[model samples]
Every structure is written in structure tokens, then in C-alpha cells.
Target: MDVVTRCVHRESSVEEIMIYTGKSKSYVKSAISAAILLGMIEQLNGDIYKISDDCYGILNTTPSEELKTSLFKSRIEKWEPFILYLKYLISGESSVVAIRKLCSLYSFNRTPVQIENLLKNWAKSTGILDATGEIVDINLSYDENEILYKLNEETVNDTNVSLFMINILGENIFSWLYHDEIAELKKAILIFRDHPRDAIQCSGRAFEDVLRRISIQSGVDTRKLNGITQVANNLYSQLDSTDNPFIHSKLKNIASAIGDIRNMAGHGKEAKSMERWELSSTSAIAHLLLTLSTIKGIYSYVNENRYDF
Candidate 1:
């Protein structure tokens, strides 16, 4: 689509497409066919083509309900029991027993190897699961073997941490994050969920990355800001002066708390007054901040709908 977009107002010949996309002639033909099917581009004046107006909006926005449903049906609807078994494993279920039970529930009448093979492909090929069975883009991990399957200690200890990770897996959450930031954020989330004592520091580090990205987008000079507190102060000052002060204040407070916890972690100190629940909640707030930053880019969509973020 990007190549086609570039070719708009000119001829989109297969030869030119091959040069632009660096793909085979067959691949170019297939892409053009799919684009036409989806109404993303249309042939014009016999040989020339152009991107459709609707394609621009569709490319930039979240997937439509029909597209989401079609994707679910193709990639996940039949594999739901496999996901269920993985969730059940978090409760300490045995893999051998779980596989048999899953097969029975689905009435597949297949052997355990077949089930494992099916899920293994899904795990390895798709972003749904990592090589170690960790849910991709979330803070959950799992281990599996011929005899058993179990949730990783980090996941089992703090189930609440998975709430946002699970929900955002297929929701286009990464559209907000840059390519390099995605890996760093994923690593931070794994540590945040798995290590309670280190949660604050992990989230604080992740929040710093979030702010850095926002600085690039909003044209703020992050290099002048020494830390999260300074960054927050500068950002609030730049926001609309007529906006609700109370809402902005809460955001500033959250940023301050992130920096404070990070300092405590740095000094090897513990806050006796704070509990795991509070740390967990802080992580949730960090996740919300990341989501809200992305939401801000699509102001038109936000104005058309109500979003708690």
C-alpha cells in the first residue's frame, strides 16, 4: 500500500512496482489484487492507478469491526481452547491433563501431539506467543513440555498485571510506539509484572521512554529537562492554558510518583507504607499514560467518542 501510495498520480505498472517494493512480479500482482478487493486502490485509465480516499483513513486508524472479526476467525476463533488452557495453566494445571481436557472439550478426538503442533505453530509464527510461550506484547509468560505446562513465576505471582497486557494484545496498541521503543517497553513490562519490588523502577523507566516519544511528537525539548518531574512541568506549561487544571495536576502527580519510586529503587530502600496493590496500580497508571499518548494523536476520533483514557 505504501508503494502504491507513492505511485499515485502515475502509472502503477508491475515492473515499476517490482522496483519500488523489491518484490517478485507475482507478489506485486497479488498485492494489487488484494488492494483492489479491499478498495484500497483502483485502476485508472487502463494502466495507471491511485489510492482510494477511504484507504488513507483506514490505514491510519484502528481496524474496523469487520476486519477484526475476520482476523479473529482466521487466527484465533478455533484456537480459543488453546488460549484457555494457557490461562488455566496459570492456576498450576498439568500440561498432559490440560491438553487431553482441551481436546475433549473441543471434541477434536485428536492426539496430544496434534494439539501441541497446532498451538506450537501459532506460538512460533505469530506475535500471539513468543518462542517460550510468553504472550507477546504483554507481561505474561508460560513454560510447556511433553509432560506439563505452567505459568512463569512472574505471571503467577501477580495476575492483575496481565489485565492491560491481555486486552491490548490485538488492539493496535503498538501503533503508538516506535519500532525500537516496542522492544524496550516489552522488556520493561515483563520486569514490572514479574518483580514486585522492582515494579516501580521498571514502570518509571518505561514512563521516561513514553515521555521522550511524546516530546518528539509535541515538539518539547526533552534534552533541557533533567528528569521526569522537569519533563512533566514543561509539558503541562505547554498544554492549553484553558484546560482543566485538576486533570493535568493528576497527570503531573503520577509523573512525580514515578520518579520518586525510581529514586527509592536506586538507593536500595523500601517504602514500608506501600503495598504490592499500590505498586500494581501504579503500573496500570503507567500503561494508561502510554495509551493516552497515542489517543491524543487522533483528536478527531476522540472528539467523536468518549474515552476514559
Candidate 2:
């Protein structure tokens, strides 16, 4: 069925199958027989066959071909708790303590022992644990508790960077971005620590995208602005001219530093650019700018409510 769907759309001839599938006539005949046996194809006439509706829908779905095939294979193998536990794993929430807490919160009428058993089943099925419910030979490291898998160096770095972002940008910043912007931000954070250069470029682009939107909202004709830097400068100029000169100077310095580092890293002008310090500092400044420019109320709220909180 897969072979047929690879080349055949609505209908295909046996001769065409031989050509496209790069198979002999006998091989094609055997594959057709296997498809028919599996109820994936129905014989319409002498040589013409139609793929089953279920099979066709599976093959032509939203997910990628590889994912679709894996899902289909797993359907035959039949994994229990199909997706819920898998989502929990992918959320990077693997600590036994966290799991127990979640079970307590959500798993109604199920004892902790039963929840642990389910986790073991899921872990074993996913190859993270062996048949004996022990950690497998996957690259994951572990702590003394033997519950949560400790992230390796690259993953740890990425997590730290993303944590910093969460602290500065606030966890709910996604509420302000469009769907595509949220996707871009997620991709940036996913690779930032491991691949700072690419992440910096992505961050710079996001900064510009967000700044443009904010500029538009501020009643500024952003279409007249030359670029993001100009827009930023104009907004900064508007921020309380009677305010303390020292604060304005510091803000200018941070903005300049962020823009310089972003440009150097993004354009690939210098080798070994955007070292750890530069990346972290620029990220901090950019986050501040993003908050102040786009979600200014958040900054105001944090400052005014800091002691209250």
C-alpha cells in the first residue's frame, strides 16, 4: 500500500507501478496481493484497484510522512495511554516529585502506586526504561533520586537560556504575539544556548517584528521609519524627556550594546562572535526593550507592584 501510494494518486496502472516502484511485474503483483490481504486496497476491475478509504486518509494527513508511518506502525503495536504520558515527557517535567504532584492533582480515584505503574509502562514502551523499569542506555543522565533524567550539557545550557527568557519576558508574553511569532520565538529558545549565533539572529528578527507592531500601535507612522533601530530610537526619545538623564543614558547604552551585538552575530561579519557573555547580556537588554516597547504595561506593573508582591 505504501509503495502504491508513493507513486499512485487516484489510480495507477500495473505497468506504471512497475516503472515508478522500480519493481518487477511479479513483485508488483505480490505487493498488490499483500495490500488486498491487509484490506488496504480493494479490487475494482481486472487490473485496477482502489486504496481503502482509511488507508488513504492515513497516508494523506496533516503530519509528516515519517510521523504518519510511525503512528500507523504504533497502531498495530498498540501502546496504552497513547499521547497523554508522551506529552508529559516532552514537557521536560520528569521529576518523580513533580509526577507525583501532578498525579495527585489530576489522576482522580487512582492511587500513587497505580500512577507509578502507568508511568513505568509508558517509560518502558518509550524505550526510556527497560523491561525491568530501569533506565535504558539512552544518552540521558540521572541524579541521585533516580527519578528525573538530568539534562546533558547542551540541553542544560538551552534550559538556562530559556529560563532567563522566561524571567525577563514573563511566561505569558505569548499572549501578545501572533501565532507565527510565537512559533519563531519557540524555535529561537529551543536552539539558543546550543547555537547562539542562529538564536541571536532569530532573536533580532523577533525584536524587529515586535518593535514594528508596537510602533504601529503607538500612533507612529512606522512605514516612514527606515528600520527597527530607528523605530527604537524614536520610542526611546519619547520616554519622558524630563526624566533623569542618567537613566536615559543607561537605557541608550544597553540598547546600543544589544543592537551592535545582534548585528555582528546575525550578519556573520566576525568569527567567534556572540560569546556566552555577549549573548546573555544582549538577551537581557533585548528582553527589557521588548517589554518596554511592546508590553509597556507589564514593565509598569512589575515596578509599581514589586514591593506588594
Candidate 3:
């Protein structure tokens, strides 16, 4: 039967084999049984059987030929997470400087230019299009310049910040900050944070929530989210790394620590000033401010390096 299957599928059958090789009937029966167990053929209604769809190639290909196949099973690999990080950078919840840091951490098949192009395509698809498309640009009395500058940095705080001005500032921060912390904690915070009363911590709280949700959705089979909890921890370590070429580790630690505090504030965690320089959170905020100041210098350095590139 095995010889018969090969003969019919590749031009050879059982009776033909018996005539050609003079095989005994019992030998033919044993061969057929072996072929059936191999799944090269599927039994149909009663005795009639057909070759399996997979068997067509199996019958033709050399063993080595089967090993060569495309590995790109899906698009939800590291690339998707890279795009998310880019959005975080653009939205001011994270920094563009993060790109270099992440590149250093992960080996990728894509170059920075390729990554940028990929992001350009994804941004267009997701309505992140051009930066200009982002704002309503209502031409309101508020200063767009100030808003952009404030967004260029999320740590900005001053007495002069107006109630409405703070509102807009908070929105940008919240939009990107949703992926900042562990998701459940972030979600619990959001249940309380979305209130009109919860403005300051909205950015960080929302950021953590977004990341957690993404991590959860990318199930084990999805590839990218398989080890995402560790990925988040790595991202946190880098963002909080003192040797980050942008800020000291102490400041990074403060940034991450205050991130939780900000969540507490957003979730109605009581009398939380959420303010940086309040004597209690002072030195931490100054170093944070110092980190921001260092970021500005790094921004300049990054651009200069980009141009040279």
C-alpha cells in the first residue's frame, strides 16, 4: 500500500506493485496499515481514502527542504511594542532619548531609520499622523507655545500655571502616562482618577493602565507579550537607571517612586500634594527637575548627533 500510494500520487499503485515486485497480499496489508498511521492518507466514508493536504508536499520534498520556511508568524512581535514606545515619546510621557536606550537593550533587525518609517506608517494608520493633526488648535486664548513647551516636559510645575492651563497640561501627560505602571494598579487608580478632582496624577496613572492592558491582551500565543512583565521591568529599570546618560539613578528612582505617588493622588489617595517642591518631596523634585534640565541638554545633544548622523 505504501508503494501503491507513492505510485498513484507520484505514479505507482498496489496491484501494480504486486505485479512488479510480486509482493504477497499480507505484505501489502502491512504496508497499507503503516501508511494509514503516517497520516499521508485520510480515510473517507468507508474504505475510500484520500491524501492529506499536507502530504502533497511531504511526498515531494526532501527532508532538508521542509526546514527552510519564513519565521514571521505575525506582526505582534517586538516591533509593536517599539511603536508604542515611540508614541509615549511623542506624547511627552516618555522621551525620544528612550529610543537609543531601548536599542541598546534589544537587538533588532530594523535600523533607526527603518523603525522611524515603520512608525510613520503606523502613526498614519492609528490617527497619530502628523503632530499637527493632534491638536484641535481652536485658536483659544491659551498659549499653544506654552502648552507645547510644557508637554516637551511632563515634570513642569509652577505657581503661575492657571487652572485651565493645568487641565490641558494634565491631558497630554495622562494620554501617554497610561502605560507607566503595572496595569491593575493603574486601573484601580483610573476608577478614581478620571474625576474632575483628579488632574495632576492622571497622566502617570493612565500611562500605567495602558501598558498593563497591552501586556494582558498579548496572550502567550501572541509572541511579544509572552514575557512582557519582564519587559516592563526592563523598561522601568532603564527609565529609572541612574547611568541612563540622561539622569542619575537616584533621580530615575525618584521619577518611578513619584509615579506611584502620582497614581495615589489621582485615585483620591488624600492630601497628596502631587507637587514636587513641598519640602517633603523637595529634594526628590529638584533632582527630578535636575533630571529635566539634563534632559533639555540631552535633547540638544541628541539633535546635534542626529544631524551629524
Candidate 4:
């Protein structure tokens, strides 16, 4: 109909408007303006234009509430993986290794403590991914031109952690063990010299202290701590027995060693290679077993003396 409409539809322009129509320029211009306002035409230039967006059927269809919510949720889920990737990078690992780890954790079977242990385990080694989901680190030794690289030996792929993590494990183990020891050692003295009721309450308080300590580091692996976590319900059973030396002396040192091992593992003091495969997983298992043994020893004392009259 007019130059703008013709341009929109690819039809002929109103080239002969001035000569063919006696209507004034102002009237033609006003009609074109009104048409453009209604999405009938687009103003490209003063004289050139095209059809507006009224062509597509979905001009302003409103989305449903459920659709909007789903859109928001989808965005959030995408963000989680990205955030995890960023965390891996910020900690100084490579992207490939990060992806491997990110790929590893699904909030399914892992707690924060386990994740922390695993990451720290890898930080000392190499060939792990970084934040951007790319291979970024290397696990090369000091030897020049003599290191072999393997893909699966990266951080997340390693089945276990390092020795340094043993210290953390051992410290927690000792804390639990020491308190039980103190309770057994002081039970009689306090019960006889002061009030038996107060002794019982003090012993309860000692247990409460244990629970508080456990709560403080809620991220630590409870499974890795089974070794020294056992406690005899009654302390009087052991003061007259042969187990006194084991509990107060030998076990104390053993618990202390577990913590040291954990510290060494976490700090990268015990990272070494294996002949057939890379060496992060098995070593971690050994350290974990030591911790478990330390806890078991504590528990064994408790079990053996659990019914002691």
C-alpha cells in the first residue's frame, strides 16, 4: 500500500505516490506512521522500512507458572556444576582433574570431609583437572626427562587419600581416646574422695565433651574413626585389672601416632609412586586402616571391660 508496507512484504514501493496520488505528503506520512505503530511496518529509514514482528504467531504468548519455575531450576542446576568446577580451580588443581572430581562427587555418597581429604590428596600430586574442566596439573617427580603420564591416576581417580590426612584422623581419635582414659583414671578417686553422684555427672560431662568435639568438626569422616571410638560404659571395672597399663600408656601413644600419620598424609609428606600404577589410593587406605585400628583398640578396651563388675 505504501513505501513502508511494500518494503516489509518485499512488494513494490509507492514510487509513483507523488505523481499518481493527489493526496498531500503529510497525509501519506501520517497513515504510514499509524500503520508502523500497529506493527504493520518497520521504519528502517525516513523513506525505507519493513514489516514488523507481527508475522510470527507467538508475538506475546505468556508462559505458564510451571514453565517459569522449571526455567529457574534448570539454571540453578547448571550453576552447581559450574560452582564445583570453580571450587576445584580456586584450590589450584587442573581443569581435567577438576572435572574428574566433579564427575566423581554427586552429593550421593560423599561428605565434605571425604571430599576435602580427596582434594588435598590430589593437590600434592599431578595430572588432575582444573576449574574449567581441562587437564591442568602434572604429577612429575624431580627427575628430568623421565616421568611417564597416565590419565586415570589423577586426583578423583585415586581410591584413597595421602598420609597427611592421617594427622587429622589421629587427632580426632586421640581426643576421644584421651577423654575416656581420663574418665577411667579419675572415676574412683573422684567417687570416693568427693561424691559418687558428682563423679557420675562428671563422667557424663566428659562424654558430653566428646560429643561436642565431634560436633565441632562435623565434616570429619565418622567411618574412618571407628578404631579408637569404643568406650567401656563402666570405668570401675578396669582400675583393678591388668588393662590399666594398656589404656593409660600404650594406647595413648598409639592414638597419638595415628594423628601424626594423618597430618603427614594431608601435608604431602608420604606421596610416593608404585611400580604398576600411580600411588595415592593404597597409601590412603593404609593410613585409614591405622586410624581405624586406633579407634578399634579404644573400643576393644571398652568391650572387654564393658561388663566388668
Highest-scoring model, TM-score: 2
Off by over 4 Å in 1: 1-170, 192-199, 241-247, 268-307
**Against the hidden true structure, what lDDT does model 1 obtain?**
0.50
What 10-residue stretch in candidate 2 is worst by lDDT?
Answer: 141-150
Ranking by TM-score: 2, 1, 3, 4
TM-scores of the candidates are 0.38, 0.39, 0.23, 0.21
Q: What are the C-alpha RMSDs, in order, of all predicted structures?
A: 16.0, 13.6, 20.5, 26.9
lDDT of each: 0.50, 0.49, 0.36, 0.37
Residue 238, candidate 2: C-alpha displacement in angstroms = 3.9
Worst 10 residues of 4 by lDDT: 156-165
1 or 3: which has the higher TM-score?
1
Ranking by lDDT: 1, 2, 4, 3
Residues 1-309 of candidate 3 have per-residue lDDT tens digits of 244244334333455445544779666655555455434455556544455665554443232322211111111111324433443444454333545544554555668665555444444433334554232212212243443334324332121122122233232222332222323222222232123124324334433344344334332122343222332443334422234332233333544554554544434424576443222223223222332332233223322322110
Instruction: Give one digit per residue, the lDDT tens place, for model 1 in 6-96.
Output: 4554557767778877889777876676456445677777656676775544333345555533332233312345455555445456655
Residue 99 of candidate 1: its Cα lDDT? 71
Kindly list the per-residue Cα lDDT of model 2 for residues 76-134, writing each as its tens digit: 22222222333334345564643564554353345666666655654565465578645
Q: Over all chains combined, what TM-score does candidate 3 have?
A: 0.23
TM-score of 1: 0.38
lDDT of 1 at 75: 31
